[model samples]
Target: MDSIPSGEGLIARMIEGDESAFTSIYRQYHPALYTYLLRICKIPSLAEDLVHDVFLKVWEIRHRINPALPFTGYLYRIARNHAFKTLKKLAYDEVLQEKVLEHLQFQGNGPEQMVNEKEYNRLFQEALGRLTPQRLHVFRLCRQEGKSYDEAAAILGISRNAVKKHMVLSMRAIHNYIYRQGLVITLLYLAQKIF
Candidate 1:
């Protein structure tokens, strides 16, 4: 029910800033790209965001796109890179949150504590932004909302094992990111839990 455009012609029009050509390319590739990202990250929302980011990057670099080259491959490479970067950032933020939480434990629970709590909340949001939509939902339900794995699974309509898997992978990513950031002292605590 859909028609495919000539890649070379589409790229040429995109280079010249043709909105219609860009739209054509987007419509053609978006579904595949989103599916690919969702499979790798297991997050529907993140997949959509990655697709958006990939297309935006494509547009920004349209002038440089080689019409003679394989467009699909080039676009996929960009998507993969974007996904990796997003994952890394998410991991780093998770570790950073742990560090912040540890520091908060030492401070008196008062106005200063409230200010730190606010900062923690901000960082928590940033970390969540890095996760795929499904993963974010799972994390919030399980951790933030204080729901059990079974409860989250029922709420999300996923298996209990699926919920556990997401949590483990998410926590592992956070620990690995913290280790990579050279936070040795914090890593010690995280490693115990992650390992």
Candidate 2:
């Protein structure tokens, strides 16, 4: 079995500019974070780039990280925020969006890819369905419709901070739902293979 390192210890060391601690954190979190970002961006190269970008940002702000708090959530928040910033830019840039679309279209996906896409879409929808009605509405407005937080707030007659809070909660809920579902699927596959 692989041993899990002490996150707080590693983080504390990283705060002291320990390269090995930072590398350990990167090794521990990279795969899952990359998968998560890939799902969000739908581009492998961009997701890989975003992963590096996130790690670099983490290293830059290591001193500010709270070693007492769970590092996974903090790391994920950074990754999510970075990915969303890139996506927000993509949403505003028609040329970039067209290029991304063209790139995706150029990639010839096989049947396996199709099945994976369907599974991902199903899990994503299920996660969305698990959100509260208000949270769901806020998510649709800001994420799906590409509305700004302020615009979403105006539409819902709520404060912008409330809209932002809803969006953050909704995203956390969605990520947790998908992660749970993924674990279940993985376990089921393992069981089938074993039995």
**TM-score (C-alpha) between model 1 and the true structure:** 0.48
The whole-model lDDT of each prediction reads 0.70, 0.78
Per residue, candidate 1 scores C-alpha lDDT tens digits across 84-156 of 6665554457654453444434443222333345654554455567777888788889988999999999999
User: In model 1, which range of ten residues has the least summed lDDT?
Assistant: 186-195
After superposition, candidate 2 runs with Cα above 4 Å error: 1-5, 92-95, 107-195
Count clashing residue pairs in model 1.
Answer: 0
- Which tens-of-lDDT digit does each residue in 140-162 have in candidate 2? 99999999999999999999999
- Candidate 1 residues lying further than 4 Å off, grouped into runs, are 1-5, 94-195
Model 2, 156: alpha-carbon shift in Å? 50
The lDDT of model 1 is 0.70
Q: Candidate 1, residue 53: CA error in Å? A: 0.4
If scored against the real structure, what TM-score would every candidate get?
A: 0.48, 0.50
